[model samples]
Target chain A: MAVSQRALEAAGLGGGRGRLERLRQWREQEHVFGYGLILPALVLLTCLVAYPFGMAIYFSLSDYWVGSPGQFVGLTNYREILGNDVFRQTVQNSFVFTGFALTLKTLLGVWLAVLLARDVRFKRVLRGAVLLPWVIPTALSTLGWWWMFDSLYSVVNWTAIRLGLISAPGPNWLGQTNYAMAAVIIVNVWRGLPFFAITVLAGLMSIPREFYEAAEVDGASSRQRFWHVTLPLLKPVLAVVILFSTIFTFSDFNIVQILTRGGPVNTTHLFATLAYQIGLQGGNLGQGAAISLFLFPMLAMVVFLQLRYIRRD
Target chain B: MASAASVRARRLRAALTYANLTPFVFFALFPFYFMFVTSFKRNAELYNLKAVPFWIQTGAITDHYDFLFRRTEFLIWMKNSLIVSVIAMSISLVIAILAGYSLARLRYRGVGSFGTAVFITYLVPPTLLFLPLSQVVNWLGLSDSIWALVVTYPTFLVPFSTWLLMGYFRTVPREVEECALVDGASRLQTLLRIVLPMAVPGVVCAALFGFTLCWNEFIYALTFVSQSGNKTAVVGVTADLIRGDIYYWGSLMAGAVLASVPIVVIYVWFLDYYVSGLTAGAVKG
Candidate 1:
């Protein structure tokens, strides 16, 4: 009784404390509705994301063909995949695709971002124009490129030959293994640059003008200012953008599958497409899942490290 | 004079800017220009190995568009895409607003931490999730329907939209809501009557993003829908153009151009939303 009385006196609720406590409780409940609002979104996320992800991991370890019962394989598939040449090549190709695409996208994105940052006439139109490739459905725009590169109907070849730039007629772009891969990479870089540009542009705009003015006052050259001022300030957002693009480019199936579908003797096969062939098309679910699951550990480690970096502020 | 020297320096800077931009402009514009010119050529003209095939030679060809529309399920595919994108956008945005409001304003235990965790979940690549998702779709018996996309898109869309809105909601002043609360309004009423009106720009941004995501998604649509009538615009164009052994180049280009039109229109309409939403919090940070 003494403790309650003391607490009431401290809170200024000793007299008519019951009514005061009820009003406070009601106010607290009212604010708690904020928590109540997120319930539906959480339910949807769990159902569609969390549950499916758990199922994918579970099925990756099992020898489950699509229509048949799954059996525990106990790393047997993983062991076999380690010995497979095609799977190894697919892994290598995925790395090459991601590596080359990331390098190109970042470089080009930075270049374009620098240009767009200048005070120019009709900059908005150019920015919007640049985003068209990124915005259009990957399959559709890639198909447009595919038709442009088709040996039989290639306007590029026809124009080149007619202009006397080449002696012979249309070159086989898709048929040649090397050219096919290069074409896909080029298309991927083209589509990705705008997104990188937009992101980097946002980053550039965010930087305070005071920094540049200070650098100018100190007689810093343009290159030095960019290297020291722009680069360091843009680091966090750039890290997020690059990490996103790397993960995306690594697992990209649409551009490759649309353009080549691992064609001309599987020269362009990446891990994701190979998984699709094995699991869905070729009907070897266990192997396909195993191939798809191959990149998970590496990605998880990288992403885990990145998450730490992002949270370390 | 020092003024003349400064003028020369200004010109030098301008020249340097031009030099830096040349490669980027050419690289960005060339292929699209190539596509635009190529789509106008007949098969014979395209095969002729000619320099600068005038796209509007005798007449700007309308045959490809006609053929694509008449010969394939292009119209139906377009309709399906519109339906799915609209429905998905509407559902995700509605859910996102409620969820975002709760997370931003509510002081429940774990709410702050949970908001960050949810945003991270949005970054989970659809590539990794699509395999198990196929099985989930099979279980739900929504295989080969546009409805499958509508159902699954929110898995990804809701997270990002909610996250985006949460950031936006944080900017809205708390006093406005407190004023509403003092006037005998409930939380829901305050959100609808007061908060949403002020948050229209943010809501529009979320809606635009949701719409674009649903419209452009290809992997899931390709994986899920195989039927001729139900395939979304992306799948329909690709599959129809390369049906069996034959590749119809003209019609495919036509379909590509047509498919891009709606996106262009949407972007133009909501240019402000794209700019603001895209640059949201970036400048401040």
Candidate 2:
């Protein structure tokens, strides 16, 4: 009680103790205090996230353009995009891009993380080296990839030819249909690999050494130990990494935009690049918003299911 | 002895790890090296069909770097990126610190739901919101300006840094905070003076990580700002440096290298904190 009185006094609430104390007491309640604390974040999100999201949905439903806000057509934009061949191809491209990129990143990421977890010399340097692609700006780094895949004076082709990996004048990476998708996927994997490896490495480091030793005592081979022990423990971390990476990969713009610009006949456009083309560049805001929001439902469901899965533990 | 064989096995495993790591490391690093090498080489060496592509046989030149600064607004773009990143990061950090503390420590109604909402917001990519946000930016008269980014970047940064800092704040001992409160400190004072100092690492981690995200942000930067003066470094290089069919390979690469080097240097200084921040967010978050 004395401490409470002193605290109130220190808060400059001694005079008019009745109302002041009551007000202080009211504000001091955990619920009110908590709300007050989070109020700034709440305001920022409501204005920036929630409000814009609502606007995005509205834009998708209406026949809006950059200059003119058209009347609401009620799913006409969605229907129109669903009927468009470019949009259809983009849908297919998004899945193929996300699917391949995620698979490669997962496989290579886990393998790299395992290698990183070893007690090797200069471990920090090696880890930093591996993370270069991830830490550098994506648009900037993708520009480098664009150069390497340049049709003329291509280093990738030069090296490949030197090593007998491919014949003279290799497939035009960004220009060809199949290789355009392949090029985007390769860059995506390269960029995403460090994220997976480092996050999973953290998971790997967290596992008790005794568990591995106990498995070893049971005569489990190295592969068996990884299968039974490391894999199970790494699931949550992997899930979180994959969940985030999936969203990032699906909405990837910088790689496709800078490298291909959804080019080679739009064979490599993801939802973002397609949305940018249709909405921003094409001035069809309604269709663009519709296309971009196309993945929101799927992503939300993934987040919902994955959150529940994580919360189970 | 079995011990000798075990040592041999371990050495072999170490050797194998190195061998496997070599290819991945090369894939990660070769691009940067190529970019750097390309940036310095003259047009003669850069365009030469016969010259070796791996390294420059001809001497390096600053012609590209000279062009980047002299002919283009590379410096201005970099300045925009720096300003946007620092200001946005500072704002998000302050907001995140408050929300993280409340979510982590306070016993409140709907706190759980609020926590989940923040996490979900982190999942909402800018691509989905950019169309509406472009309008919103225009509505507020911030379009074609750095203020547009300063205003919207927080939509993503706040949620992520808030969630991460919640995990960080939860690790801070409640007893210390309580002690401060009992001694006549107000709640706000306690948070600012007592709790914040202890979470310095988390704060630094959040700042460095958030700054990098801001610097690296592309789509919003590309879409929101269009004028040459207002563009961020990443967008400026891609948008301006590549004119027509004639590729400015040397200057474009110079721009890429210059844009990437600042982030690379910052990460090097705080690499462990970056990892620790991730572990906290991934494992605890």
Candidate 3:
């Protein structure tokens, strides 16, 4: 992250006594230049990011609504939301959605990665195919999933019935609570799977091949090699991916918004979607702000651990 | 006999690998294929419960696409999406290049704190702040316009692009930049003229990802812009197309296909850069 000190000294050694020299003299003060360079980024982020973030906290604490003058209410919004059953359902739904999605993503991701890392033909094409789900926009792709899960023309149910996996007119996917959750989870897993596969593939590619040879030298089976050599070395990458995925999954909005709109008795509402429903559509700015702000503490803990984990390395 | 068995085992493992990958590939791509095929099938075939839903047996037609263009504001939304993505990506890249160079190459006092600030800012998800941001946008008179998206898209884009570019900028040799400095080139001049050229790939990588993010963003675009003409493609397709409970499946799929095609095409061409950006964001941490 630095130019050599010798280079700085060498830069300072240049001699001149004119405007060009003044400019050269200015170059030696590198930190000033660095500060100057970073200012625009700082300004933009402060106004757009930090200010809005601060306002979010302020919003949750006040009795605010869209276009209404909000007055400080000191946790009243939080208390009201805490008493709400729909909000409670939302918290449970978020955890359930995240729990199922992350578990599947991790297991499938590592397996797909190991498979991708193998010496296979058309590797680039295969890798590209696997990564396609992630490249497409979620709102659009989830619409595709929504079409497949349609109550009447549900191809998912159609295939299931044809294959004898379920009975005719199979479960009302978006209309029934359990089926709706499953449909959303399935789409989430479908959308999020490639992210896991590709990232883990990168981690797999980074491991030294000699580790495998060394394991085999000691008479290790392929399973043993994976368990002992690959999985342990992959832990750091896995942890980071999990943490990031947890944050992404917890804060997810588009999938639920498009697929169910937290339908069938709000059985599948995530915090973001709940916040949208309550805050924007319901026009309860304080409650919406509070609902979303609830995610902050948990995610901040994840980010903290993430920073600590990365820093330790 | 042992040599023959070992060869057979190798062949067996090879077959197993593809077999395992088959389902994953299908799971990953079948929805897209479904979307594409559904977009083309005529309404009669699509709604015929007796017909096989997997393929277009009644021959492909562009009627849905024709209806989308003729009846809906699909073209306006796409044009808006393009405008927002281009403007936001360009601004984020410029800011990210400077910030990335600063954090990666400069050893100034408080540089560590600034880096942490960017890191902290990057972790602040848009979901959490969209409510307050909507208020902010209202105050700025950018409500119901693409201008709101253009302004706010950079919040997420800049931190990510800066973080990604920070890792990328670190990989460029310090000697080249230092050499440029020692030769009496100003740091700004050195950065702009010498170091930036070498870091073009990083810039392009950031640009590609930055553009993808802007195009793919939904919540802010959905929350910020309400006008049909100002809605980004993703938001417009979802918010406007499906009226009441009657989803125009064929035309909806068409809208989905049209909205997703540009970014998908871009990603297919630069798959490597895109993956590297993904890894740089997650793995590098």
Candidate 4:
């Protein structure tokens, strides 16, 4: 109200007999206009994100299934999930998957970005092709990988055998537990690398050429320039990309669901896929919600750290 | 002699650069290449492990494409994806434009916190919300309909587009709106006539990104829509084409290729906007 009143005054709606009354009216009008403008988005967010989020929290605390009403149960859902071996395995799997994928994506992304930032023929074409894994839908692309990793018809094994690198067919990529996990991680890395590469390339391109020239004039070697200047300048962008990718990969459902379906004794069940398996498929809404939320605290911390970094920048 | 040495050095560098790039290029494009070639192989060629798997040594066939259109619900899935994406795009665009304008230009209370709220909402991953959202979809009686996606997609889309558009709207000169107001244009009129026209690029960027996000969305579509005919392309192809122990490799690859074509076409055409939109959104956050 105070801000709106000041705005009304700024707009010269303050000039009149009974000026305070006119100011109030104008303030009210501005208030209405502002809220009206934002109402649709606000309402949609409230209904979709906020309400469901609240419901998820509640569902995690109760004994709710799909159709029936849930009764309040204090810490029972969390305790049960913690005690469950499958739940423990899923948590470990998620961390392993996210850690491996993020590390590979960052390393590969930086290498690719540096290469792309160079003057090369067919750079645009290469960049466009690099983005295919990302631009296409994940499930569809993962399906292709699933076929490539198929035990009987795997092209990878065929290539390997044809090249005389292996005497027998390649290992069953998705049949064994460890192999299944590797397959999903490989697909995740493949899908996410383009995002990292493209974003980091954008960051690299924005680095002022004058900075490099100055470093060169000071007799700085290429490694010294990269360590001293490029890394420091690229920190903000790198932080944002890493955090974004971490959150995304941690919550990833598509690759795991489409490729292995968290199979071979539940070895590759990510939190999201596990949640869907338990909560939706098994119809144990309460336990499913609890499993899904196991990573909420970590996500909140990441979000908090990211917001702080954003503010500092 | 010096000139010859420098020329040799340059040639070596060029050769080494291309050699280094070979792995990246192959890693990026091989899956699609495999998918394309596999889509053309006959059932016999597909199952034959003795033949060269990398290329179609035999003639290409359209049997998979024929099966996809004539056998499965691929077309319905495509139509559903288009409808849901378009409607979701329109809704998100309209809401985002207005909210972004308000947050950027309007002097109002709680604007800062409201903007932050929107950003935080963008960070809330769909994994946490999908279960409860499924329940909400059921409650709204939109469980198996495309409308479920149409309404729920904005959960992620609006926040993102609003944040993107807010950044764009802030770059719009304030004087343009002030001039419109000074010329006795109503606020709504100023927004409609002057501000919106100026923000067309931002709007288009937001719309394109929104559409792509909607199209690529998977979990919600999988959870909410159980019926075969109601699935989106991504969900339908993944869920329907693969049966137990018997993968329809040809038809599945065909579906994958076709499902990808629309968004791929748009991405290639507007590659610049898509790249900028992604990086800009990331950098702003």
Candidate 5:
């Protein structure tokens, strides 16, 4: 009974204690300190990300431009964008571009990661070399690609001709619709493949070697071992990587903007570049806001799925 | 006989693997190689149909480098990029260290949801936010200033740094902090004195990633800063180099090469941390 009473006093659970009151006060201070520590980050995030997100949605519904105040005009901007031919084409183009680029990146990333995980000679050098496209800024690297794909001075064409692969100058890459799309997608894959390879390689490294050893001892072939042990273990990491990459690829701006600038009859305009065109350049802020918001629903679905997966873990 | 056939098959498989890897390696490195080679090529060599495209002509000229330095605002852009990247990185590290420590160590309500919120914000790509963010920048009267990029970059950087740091902080043994607490150390002192020193690699990783991100930022820098002197390398190179119907290929290549050198050097120096930091966030998240 005495020990219980003393413990209560120490915790300030008993009324009107001296040192125990100071202890309670210190605990309260710590509680407030937690909030204080998070306050700056929270405030900054609200101003930069959260507030802008809300304004983007509001701007989508208003007739806001660069210089003029906007009037609320619900669904008008969305309807027009949905109905417009350029916007429609861009919507299709964004999907195609993201889909093809991501598919290729995933395949190549897995293959590269598998190779990298092996005990190859000069492995560190090879890994560093492979990551060059990713570490360099996309805009700068894409510029190099732009020069390489120049209609008249294309290096690719010169090499192809020398190798007897083509008899004539290569087609203008960014001047044609399909070729423009292909060029942008190619650059996107090149830059993005390293991300997948590195992340998947990390995933591959985390799997216990004993699992592979056990499988081999059970008479499993390399292919069978990969299917049974590696794929299942890699699924979680792959899910997270794919989800993140999809969101990124869908919102990609630099690659398209730098390479194609939504050129060749606007066949390469993703949501971002199209928004930049209409909002900033064309002075139609409301419409641009709406166009950018088109990505929101799709990405929100992805974020929701990702959150659920993370929570389950 | 079976063993010999299997050995031959393995050899063949190894050859095929190398064959598959060769093209990918070539594709990955070719653009950079082309950029370097073309940067040094004389304008005459660049235009000549008879010259080989892959190799630079003997006694290649540095006229493009001369042009980039003398005729363009390349140096000013480099300074601007350095200034903005450093400021943004410092601010991001400070905020992320506090926020990450709080989320990872402090006992508090709503930390789980708060951490998730930060992750979700990270997921909110800059593309969706840039339009409204531009308006906000205008409102702050920061457009056309390096401060615009310095302030805006933290939106992406803080969340990423915090997320990475949170993972790092979690890996730290909790008993160390508890012992400090028992020794009558405040949380702040403990974090600064004890935890931070132990977490140097994590902090360095965060700093490197954050700095590289700020250096690489494009769309905001492109949109917010239009003045020639204020533009960063990526934006300036794209805008000023390509005149309509006349691509200054050599100078553009030189500019690209110059812009990439600092980042490439950093990547080479910190390759392991770069790879692990990148993958740790994804795998952990």
Candidate 6:
């Protein structure tokens, strides 16, 4: 009887060990299959992103045009762009556009989120309506704005005249340096605010009601509660909004191209449109590449700082 | 006491509501209102330029629409855009879902950290790359072809699509897949029959994202497609605007309205999914 019972226990142990081995083999096979699954993405990225990056770095140093023979210029292209007044001004304009656009959008977005959070009539309609400009393609909408600002026949001019806001139809909006810049900035802010509002609304929703209740119970006014309670809670989303807006505004080409085409004597030029004009249109590939090379450092600094803030949040 | 408290709360809520919404309502809707009114006016009326049109002209003509369709290459551009967008969206969706599932569920050597790192590459600005890419396109002999856009768009699409799909795939329970494996199903079979159907929302979300990204693409489209007839709708629309002394404002607005229709419909249909998809991984900094 003892030998029979010992044999039974040995068989049970052997069967359990076999199942474990089988499971291990299955896991190994799954891992292999998993790698196979990711093979397409890996290959696509390597060819599309990685190769292009290496090529960009190489071309930045070479004097290459669309139809002309390429020659190695080696830092000359970079130096030329660095010294160029238009390039420097564009870099400055990008910062200005980003700074103003981000600040206005954030304030307006937060205010909108706060409004939407309260009970209001037609809230659903308002919510849907607010996202329209953002939903519309930037190219199409900016084109629409272009017609509105037509120097020959501007509706805004007509209206301002009718409303007695201005004495005459006024100067050519697209021709003037300052008004053109202001128009583009306004369009950027208008296009960007929906994203900000929706994102900030989501952020506001994540904050606990108890914080506001606590603040109110302590006899805090709405302003006090906002500064002390809402602002702190909303920091992470605000940071993200600003960061994304900065990146997008910095890289923006469509609106500027449609409206001004970096015109009014290049007063409204940004790095991206200028790069396109110099490189592709003017047929100076190296110079265009040089203008764009600053993209990496500028974007990296903003992304790095914002990412740190986000991580802390 | 309860009645007084309720009344006070109602009044406070009303005031709060007004305060929150006053700026955004005007901010969002004014441009749309302006566009609608502009589309209805005759050239003379449009040129007359008033603050707002006083009357809705039953005489709003479809002449601009006719001009856009017949006079310009608008139809062809639209057709090319549709063909390109559909193909790109379908490819990205399928590839992204498979890769996202693999990254989310399966363990491989160095896959975990590497997957997240791969996603960061999406944030790299295209401004730096387009010039060199133009050279690469020239070398490949693909300049002035729609096919060039097809090749390059996936660079942007795949990373975002994969990231979104990965986040989405994580929310699914593992037990569901285990059951499929236990039933003698291969991983592919399980992914097809069990994983995909369950992950339709995510797949749909990825498809929409891919579709929009390809649709709204400009820089590469502008750089690559050089021929006038070969231009995409985005490039084509701008090209159409310059016909020397005859700026077709009505047709342009009509085209603008037309271009946004498909996307607007998409938004209206699947807004909740679209919003969640766009904003999900976006906040991760």
Give candidate 5 regions above 4 Å deviation.
A1-28, B1-16, B244-247
Worst 10 residues of 3 chain B by lDDT: B242-251
CA error at residue A192 for candidate 2, angstroms: 0.3
Better model by lDDT, 3 or 4? Answer: 3
Root-mean-square deviation of every model? 6.4, 3.0, 4.7, 4.8, 5.3, 6.6
| lDDT, candidate 1, A62-180, per-residue tens | 88888885888788888888898887778777878888889989888887887788876677777877776777677777876787787775656766777899866656888888888
Tell me the tens digit of each residue's lDDT in model 2 across A204-260. 999999999999999999999999999999988888888878888898888999999
Query: For every model in order, what is the number of clashing pairs?
Result: 3, 0, 0, 0, 0, 3
Residue-level lDDT for A255 in candidate 2: 91
Fnat for model 5 comes to: 0.75
User: What interface RMSD does each of the candidate structures achieve?
Assistant: 2.5, 1.1, 1.0, 1.5, 1.2, 2.2
Share of reference contacts found in each model: 0.52, 0.87, 0.82, 0.73, 0.75, 0.65
Question: Model 2, range B1-285, lDDT digits (tens) per residue?
Answer: 999999999999899999999999999999999999999998998898889999988999999999999999999999999999999999999999999999989997899899889988988888888999999999999999999999988888999899888877877899999999899887888889998999899899899889999999999999999999999998999899997765599999999999988998898999888778776776676
Name the regions of candidate 3 deviating beyond 4 angstroms.
A1-24, B1-4, B245-247
Per-chain TM-score of chain B, candidate 5?
0.95
Off by over 4 Å in 4: A1-31, B1-4, B244-247
Q: Taking the tens digit of each residue's C-alpha lDDT, what string does model 5 give over A1-313? A: 4576688878877664555556545754655777878888999999999999999999999999898978999999999998899999998998999899999998889899998887667788888888889889889999999988888888888888889998887788889889899999999999999999999999999999999999999999999998999999999989999999999999999989988889989999999999999999999999999999999987898889999998899
Q: Say what the interface RMSD of candidate 2 is.
A: 1.1
Can you list the residue pairs that collide in candidate 5? Answer: none
Candidate with the larger lDDT of 1 and 4? 4
What proportion of true contacts does candidate 1 retain? 0.52
Query: Candidate 2: DockQ?
Result: 0.82
Q: At residue B254, what lDDT does model 1 achieve?
A: 78
Positional deviation of residue A308's Cα in model 4 after best superposition, in angstroms: 0.5
lDDT, candidate 4, A85-143, per-residue tens:
99889989989999999999999998888888877898878888888788888888888
DockQ of candidate 5 against the true complex: 0.67
For candidate 2, please provide the TM-score of chain A on its own.
Answer: 0.92
